[model samples]
Target: MAIDLAPISLPATADAEQFKDFGREILGVNPGGMSEEQMKEVHDLLHKYSVLLFRDVDVTPEQQYNLTKSFDPSSENHGHGNDFSKTPGRKLFELNAIPGVPQVKLIGNGTVYNHEGLSEAVLKHPSHTTFHKTHVSAEDTAKGITRFQRWHMDAALYDLNPPRVTTLYAKVVPQGPHQTVRYDDGTGDELEVPLAATAFVSGKTMFDILSSENKSVAVRGRVKYSPHPYAWMATAHALSTGLGIVSEGLEMPDDELPLWDEDKIKVYPMTWKNPVTGELHFQVHPCGVRELFVDPLPAVASREGALYPDGAHLTNLMYKMQRPAIAPSLVYPLDWRENDLILFHNRGLLHSVVGELKKDQIRAFHQCNLAASDEPAGPTPEDVRKYA
Candidate 1:
């Protein structure tokens, strides 16, 4: 297919040179403020890095929304709002907050019941008291609480026409502790796990799996919790035994829980070709992709031979050889700061938030997937080299 390569040129006043270094240092460019040049540079940097970070800009929530308009005119409100109880000035998103609705807090210490509901008992007590000391052991509570810490790429779950951009503005960053981590797939620094591996774990080819037509079969007639269609697949993969289990649902078994073997499966490669820009990026997320397009044998063997059929195994092994062709090292790590705004090309890069921070420290950020529908094709050495 002829990919879309519409040129989103930098605005006339923007200094392309000043922002080019942003691609080298951090995901965001220093747009300083509303200067025409700064705004244009910010726009260019958004396309280049896929994620941008601006520090101490002090723009109001309205100005922040206006700033996002430079890149995406149709940007909408999404992601968790700031914790009003803890910090009054902090409003993560500009949408109107309801009166009786409990204030939302972004700290990692809170309890997350299924479907975005918070436990009343947990809410009544302080996070440190309810979670750290009593209700459940802190260790167990920590694991359960952090399950939602890294949600999927905002757009990955959707079947709608792709959104243009997602913006996250942080108003309250705690002192000395919380930091957000991000990864970019477009920069040629993304880790590549093959397509075949994704198919094996999913029990279907990645292409057939993500198609909107298959949503009914994949979800099994139940109403999906999130609007993002891929959310179910990502959640299933994350909960699978090979991938690594977080907590158990009523029907899942203990042995079937997912396990994280970083050494065995360090990355997942999703084929994303941008329709507007014709650029291809190999993307990875925390969702469980053990081997590029391959299935790993379970610790226990089944009488049926392997958990997956032979075709799955062969496809996975074959994709392994192709890994060298894509240059797996194209993935890069994103460091976090107190007040950083980072935007990344989700289709171009496989990104993840490395679990490196301590419990007490907080890392808060919101993300939305820029909408576009360019089907994933196999990766090419040239595509990898262009970003590298």
Candidate 2:
């Protein structure tokens, strides 16, 4: 069954001033001198809409910092800039062009390789280098210019306590269609297999494997197995299922892997619960999840199957069962304009930059992350201590 998300309602005491403070704190954008009643109204609207767009409000770097401080004191800069250089202790993400390719510059660097001057040295080096690479305009046609490409979450590799909120503020808008698209995870139409699917899978398999009673015992036999009893069981499971023993590994056949054709693989419901609000959001990002789990028994029985029949069978079954219920429920078209600043909750939303803007046109923006607040009062210290 699809889970329904009720729209957030505002209380009678909602005011605009309160909202200004809230926005200032969370977004670092201040709407000067809003009354208390006005703040409440804005607060209600923010909770209800989950996004706020401010147009024609030209703000300096310091002012932006002050505004974001209203929500999170630790607001970090997200784009390439020397604008706030004077403000020490402020986190900044610099952007630059990829060398040799004079047209395109590096956006946010991820786990992929960072290259310089079209050489193998750049290809082999890690993507995130300490210093700025170079800046190139789209008109540098001497070298073929390509679009900047990236697909990832803000920061998933880090083990931080509270995930930082991401904010992107547009600084320059070239005469082209370079816009960002966002998907709401809380919407029923965005999810597949429902929240119940995760509950079922976790309860049935993951829980069973972690139980003390289910732990396999060592078999002292002809092959001289290691004293670690679970080693054989774990190894057999990985080889048979092509999954993790202690780490994630891939063994997919080239033909079976997803193709980048227009007909892409169907997305599944990736369930994530907000640590602060305790609300469940359906994630569909293709960052951490490589493929779905499938039933291997039926495919294994077949004598002639594709390369790695067990793996293929498992993946196909999982994908079929977990096809997205609502494909474009949260998608909205982007209308790129000057002095247009848009803010949305990354934790509860899935967004994409879809508009096809040419290489010559520049689309500049700034992004920042909001820090998490303390937990609301409910459970006793002892209850919390148990989890701790």
Candidate 3:
């Protein structure tokens, strides 16, 4: 049997270093009107790249949702029954949508044209408010927490099974250099950085660069994460202590956020196999990990050494493991353009939005996420016996 894929042209600006023969920037095809054959080509290409950039394309919220389904049938996934709107009736999350479209959320920032009615309500959303131009207080930095300036996988905080694909479309973007974005190292060391770009780190490269020992740690080991509440309040409550949840989301009267029980914290294998490509990808969500534990837990202490203490050793190990993943060679900072649509494999990449928006900036992006395909992340009993 032969597979006849649709004819899709990859733009010359698709570039070399970032693509590495995997990613493709399709500026030629009209994804909104792509046939099933072309859609399959896009799907297969996405597995190879783990990231796909579609620039200057005009796709509506509904059209975007339909296009995503062309790749992953599960993109239209419904109700996992965990609350806080998983699928939102199987629709795209329109940050600017008002009056409530059935599946889309109106996360607008209240500055857009004709958005006066929703400005007040949308401004109340945490992502719009509480953003900072620089690190908060010296005390906050010393404690090892700032806003969501670090890299993270989407939905790793709340979803027991996080999404496989995360899509974002730029409806409105803040233009020009901002007056305030800065970097502070907590020791009075600061550097100025431009605002308004999103950066992506390749987990595949992260996995490939590991040493044999760290590679074992990358694949076989386990990493824990803060509970849902702390993960929820990360923007306001990202703590160095790795404990406690203190943010407005918890105190607010709205039911938009979920109140998580500590007993249900997130934990996953350090690496996982992408079901589509069968390629092993480094799986630890860098920002949210509680600690990088050696293979299994203290329950199996009989086989371990006394000198290998927990605490800061594991924390330091987590940082060492993630450092190479953030290097300039592996990280690509996207220059956002108007109507740019990006499809990223949430399982294989770590992404962070750079810069802070002033009160008047119109920088809202539409997000459409596919539901999870695999089990709750981690090593299987087979993995434990083979690697642990």
Candidate 4:
């Protein structure tokens, strides 16, 4: 029998035909102050829609932090920045106190905050030479797959539990020549706009499109991701899943380098069912996967591993995810506006910064990762200690 999960009530903007504006807004409600019921609605809708964008809105960083806290109050704020609210109650002190209040991570260093400062700092970056190799140079810019994304589940590379939700508030959105991007396989509609758009594809969607043979491979497949230690800094990272313009930050200590072999690699399930929506989801960190194995996967927490992927299976799965041509419409690039606040489910979707940054362009956003979850859409890693 089909599971009868009565649909949750949606906001006024959630009408079926109104799906045209799905990426833009899920029905505007104040972010600064949210009611309990309102918060639940947001979570439901977030699961229903892969990404929820609120555009041209006014919100202070603290308010944004508070709002996200309402979703997952236990969420630790990795908020970094010098944006100290001086006002008595409004001031944010990351050092000592404050429980229940959501930690607003103020990730800085982009042009939005200190372009001149970052320019000089990045030049002296330790990875200066390495960062160059991965860069799409000016002469080679117009060539093939300029905006290629290996795609990732947020923080998938870290030995910690990946964030459940990621809220990025646009600090400075760029203006440029427009490009038309598909929302889903050509069956739906196309959005044309300017600046660099962030692309997202649902893991649930990816799972649905897999062939039965591939699905079996996915269900049984195991991938070991060796997340680059310098992953926090977008430019300095080894992989190509760029996170836009992040400031030159800390370097990975010599000891933190990921081992190239399966012994040191973090294993994750290729496919699993979502406990929240019961929708099938996957844990694919393409950029981080150092080794690919087919069939019997590593045992969940030392019970003895299962079949690993053969060369052919590994090749096929990577091609499906890397090419995504079979699921062409799965690509949905969020065309950003000046003040768009995007609250997206990082677990459900694979995101990548699309388009190359021009010489003088500096795009930055206030970002926060909330609700660290031990849950994986599919399988858990080999060493459970790395995750929450």
Candidate 5:
């Protein structure tokens, strides 16, 4: 016998009006204990919509891990690896393990005491100030202005395959007035978002909005990520908007990284095909990518105006291609609530942590993502022929 779950709904906020093709809210499913049938539907929904939110649900750390793992049953490693003790300079993620369920991490800001074998853990949330080259001043921050910390997918970009999905369960949501997110990239773009919201943009939309010439570039391109990406970027500063790193030659040399194997280094397609939708999503993690390789246009395709690529143009090209999808009109800033669990397709969307939290405001969430058993599928031969 199979279980029938309630149908998924669309987000009701006015902000959702801007995005007609993304986000779905699952009404009556407790992800922790879904039946096989229910899980299949959940999986399909996540791929089709890119993001699925389950509000007001109680889930233990172990249950969260189970739910995330169900997306790819063969996967067991955490998206960024379960152990960080060996990597001394990993500043990308501050993962505090839940005592028993080390797979699900407790991430947030402020002090958490005696909750999960962490007697007194003072969590420091990843902030744009620390990572970005230019950030809003303290005085401007006081006026409710903030910046997106970093825009990326939830992949380790290394030995492990990229996770298929990521689950974030909000335990404590701090409340404050909405802040303005300033791009500060000379575009003067800004978005008013809730404090500490996670902003997402559809990768499918990213590909769809591209000009034909750019689309040809996308399907034909591949991104080679740095080995031990987090360690390599430890000393690098990101662009003002956290879109990618500024190429100041400040990256840690390969010799300085954690003895990485050349075989373990990942080079993925610039566009990943959604397993369920068969849609090509422009899914590059600009921050981690070290090189871009573009295949020449197919025989019948017109190369009269196609852009030639090279090693020197990696960051700028990626930024230009991806920046449009994150405009205020396309972004979905998730205003989190306590007990709200969000499961997003890690391969189909790009997300960022927006706004800042004061010291006294305690925000705790359990995040789990399993490194997938395989790499993402890129554009097929047919796809390339059609686009290029």
Candidate 6:
């Protein structure tokens, strides 16, 4: 079967370095209404590239919901549960549903009046200052310096399964000068990003760069996420770079969290296997992780210099492993334009909002992701044997 469309490597941009090769863009395709053949090609391209960009698209909220559902037919509601009003962690997300199509939510900064049935809504853009323990001062921000708001995969981390993909349609984009992202962690790292861009890093690249010993540990490790993770971390402060939390025990006490069932808690592998490529990816949402479990190496394998035979904790270990992957040289910040639709493999990458938006700089976008019907696939026994 020959697919009609061809995807090109991500174009050169201020934040994108030519050396990194993870994202692709398909030109001249209507994502809202794709034929079965086109959807297959797009799906395969997405798995292979991890992120797919569609420029100059015209899609409605209902169309966007249908397109997102096409990727996961069994999925029916929003990724965090459809009823935004009753969801426990709804406060964590600054979202407003698109009137009739509850699956698609309105996101972005500033006020949007009478939009898709929303009458006069005030939006607050996510910022590191509110979440990070330390951040760039107003003086630095005035000088066009900022920090990443958060580094995470879009998921509820509870009863519902993680979404397979997330669709974001930019309806209105604010125009402004580019800002420099400062990693205030004493490393002096910086990235020149477009104002209010979405930055992404590839999980496959993160796994491929790890040492052999770490790879073995990753394959054997499982992460237990806190129930209602967003609400649990609501009061916690993140690290300066937003890669992980400051482990000063700021997490909400288990008894104080919303009513939760033990059976509904999620425990996922540290390394998830890509369904189409069969490649292992080191995927973990550091902020939501509550506990780490690891199995001992195979009897035949050497345990010379291994990690965590008993168990592990979130004591800078996650930051040490994940920090390198988000280095400025490796990140790709997607510069948004009106009518630009991006379909990203939610399982294959970690992303973050890069800069802040002024109150007057209005930006409107429709975002949609449906809870997956199944959990992520983990490393196989053969994989454990090979690495262990």
Best by TM-score: 6
Cα deviation in Å at residue 148, candidate 2? 12
Per-residue CA lDDT of model 5 for 1-388, tens digit only, reads 3334333342333345445557778877788899888899889888988888888999988899999989999998788777856543567768887887777888999998887577887787788988887779999999999998999998888888989999999988999899888989888888888889898988999999999989988999998989888888878999977889998898899888878889999999999999998999999998988888888777777767776633123545798999888887777788899999999999999999988898999989999998999899999999998988
Model 5 compared with the native: what TM-score?
0.94
lDDT of residue 52 for candidate 2: 56
Q: Where does model 2 exceed 4 Å of error?
A: 1-44, 74-153, 161-164, 177-278, 290-326, 371-388
TM-score of 2: 0.40
- What TM-score would each prediction reach against the true structure? 0.42, 0.40, 0.68, 0.63, 0.94, 0.95
Which of the predicted structures, 2 or 6, would earn the higher TM-score when compared with the native?
A: 6
Encode model 6's per-residue lDDT on 272-362: one tens digit a residue.
Answer: 9988998888899989988877788777777778776544554345677789888887788888999999999999889998897789999
lDDT of 1 by residue, 277-325 (tens): 4444333333322233322323342324322322132212222211222
In order, candidate lDDTs are 0.31, 0.29, 0.53, 0.49, 0.85, 0.85
Worst 10 residues of 2 by lDDT: 214-223
Order by lDDT, highest first: 6, 5, 3, 4, 1, 2
Q: What clash count goes with each model?
A: 45, 29, 3, 13, 0, 0
Candidates sorted on TM-score, descending: 6, 5, 3, 4, 1, 2
Looking at candidate 2, what is the lDDT of residue 290? 34
Task: Summing lDDT over every window of 10 consecutive residues in candidate 6, give the lowest-scoring window.
Answer: 10-19
Query: How far is each candidate from the true structure, as Cα RMSD in Å?
Result: 14.9, 17.6, 7.7, 10.4, 2.6, 2.1
TM-score of 4: 0.63
